[model samples]
Target: MKYFCLRLLLQSVSWNAPLRTACSSQTLELKRMKLPSTFQESSKRFVHQVPATEFVAFTRSFHGTTMGALALTSEERFHEPFELVMPGVTFVQYGSIEEAKRTIRKGKTAAVFVEPVQGEGGIYTATKDFLQALRTFCDDAGALLVFDEV
Candidate 1:
């Protein structure tokens, strides 16, 4: 009886192959439409070269939708099926220096990601204390502090 019940549950929770296919197609379309020029990519060396392991990006931050960029996104709605796609990214609440400090203290954090002015997370500005704490924590932890100016 347990085996039968488990089989039924598995069947009910099976993957939606069609939806997956459609989403993939749409993603390809979006990529083509949004691909920046090669010149533009080269113009910004900072964006091109940055080692982001467990980057601490804020919720609703906007970097891009490319797999690399998407990994930094904190919103579940934007990064649904791509949860472990980029692996090692740690998401945290936007505000609160205490939270940031605690998170940084976790160790193995490669980078402390933040926005000087968060545009996607509703145009919110980070507090001075929060930014200061982030800088100090990164310095103490030997982690790179990345400020998303975009």
Candidate 2:
């Protein structure tokens, strides 16, 4: 393969990994599912009694095609098919700090998912101010800040 990161392309296989170990997609799935869910579950189960079931995602940002991820996406095409199964997700204009503030609530927001550089809708990069504001919002709301680097 060309490289591990480009494995999805199935071009070539590079040798001499940082560590000699086997890998699988399950590893990535477990890692991905763990981080975001942990904050929500821990807060509701152990710390805060409020259930942060809602999420804040950027409009026009494409997270994925999966049910949960598709719900977070702003595109209507992907969500139209699985509208009933998709969870509720709040969307704010990308890079709009003020809009995000209005959408994210302390007891309601479970997590804020964003792609620093959006690729699907367009190649739009998040502003430093927007990211910094998100950090503060997550901390104050006791939510997790998840960056989808895909």
Candidate 3:
């Protein structure tokens, strides 16, 4: 198609016409192009034990830490080295359809957590298709879709 445009330009046509045609073609090409997602990393989870070990605390296990709740905390450094985390939590790559499918298929998963806009993971929003695929996977595995909205 580009070659055809060049041929038309070389013929006895007005230069303005060919220039407009080339510009419109370029716009169409640009529209066809797609850019990759900027954010594509898993959110980290950190767990901590309670500080108080009193008689009541032993059973109840009250906790103390500078670290805030995991749902809305935007800083990864606050939970650096992610200590004593849960064993079964699977953090797949953001926007990774294959990894999400595999993790969901493991059959023991309790919940599939996701954020529509990953505020901590560089403010990355997932594609609709990716989210749909995850929804399907979670449904098949009988897992809950925990949308961790931040």
Top candidate on lDDT is 2
Question: Candidate 2: where are CA atoms >4 Å away?
Answer: 1-50
Q: Rate the local accuracy (lDDT) of all candidates.
A: 0.52, 0.58, 0.37
Name the candidate that leads on TM-score: 2
Each model's TM-score, in the order given?
0.61, 0.65, 0.46
Q: Looking at candidate 2, what is the lDDT of residue 99?
A: 91
Q: Over all chains combined, what TM-score does candidate 3 have?
A: 0.46
Against the true structure, candidate 1 reaches a TM-score of: 0.61
9-123: candidate 1 lDDT, tens digit per residue:
1122223232223223122211111232221122223332334345576766765656556656677766665667656667778877777777775356666656556668477
Clashes of each: 0, 3, 0
* Model 3 residue 63 CA deviation in Å: 18
So what's the TM-score on candidate 2?
Answer: 0.65
Candidates 1 and 3, the one with greater TM-score: 1
Sort the candidates on lDDT, descending order.
Answer: 2, 1, 3
Candidate 3 worst ten-residue window by lDDT:
53-62
Cα-based RMSD of the predictions, in order? 18.8, 10.1, 20.1
